[model samples]
Target: MTKKRKKEKFYVEEGETVADCLNRMAANGYQPVRRMEEPVLKEVKKNGKVDVEVSHQRIMFEGKLKEE
Candidate 1:
């Protein structure tokens, strides 16, 4: 019988590279199942108008525990 897969999300911290995060996950016996990225937007008001600006990008990694 196969066990249910478990998933978790991880973020890339400041001064930390994506590779570092992935390695950390692997060390915990998890493998990356999916990769995601999104933009962090901020609202700016100028000239009686509002605009959305991308302040930074968010990197996310979804991992599933390996069944050993």
Candidate 2:
């Protein structure tokens, strides 16, 4: 029989380091399997035209439960 796998998302908090997030996950018996980052974007319009586009980066981790 094969063990079922589970996935969960973790968001990095302000002032928190990636290592800190990984350590916290380890304490909860979960290990990070993937890393993902997406851009948070917004458009600014002025005088019926797009003036500028702004973007920010969001970091997330996908974790799976550790096998005993």
Candidate 3:
């Protein structure tokens, strides 16, 4: 049998709540060990100049495999 990863990263999908993401991790036999958020950057042109802005925050979780 293939070895399963001890740790994995999961992203909160669009339209999904944080609780929903946790539930998903539990369903996959993993427990969340850490939560993180990072800004999503986007570029916009204004008056022939490009400006970078934070579009949104991306939520992610670090999961560890549950011990049986």
Alpha-carbon runs more than 4 Å astray in model 3: none
TM-score of 1: 0.79
For this target, which candidate reaches the highest TM-score against the unseen true structure?
Answer: 3
Task: Give the TM-score of each candidate.
Answer: 0.79, 0.71, 0.94
lDDT head-to-head 1 vs 3, winner:
3
Encode model 3's per-residue lDDT on 2-68: one tens digit a residue.
8779999999999999999999999988999999999999999999999999999999999999999
Predicted candidate 3, C-alpha RMSD: 0.8
Cα lDDT tens digits, model 2, 1-68, are 66545777888777899999999878877899999998877888889998656577778999999888
lDDT of 1 at 41: 100
Query: What is the C-alpha RMSD, rounded to one decimal, of candidate 1?
Result: 3.6
Predictions in order: lDDT = 0.89, 0.83, 0.97
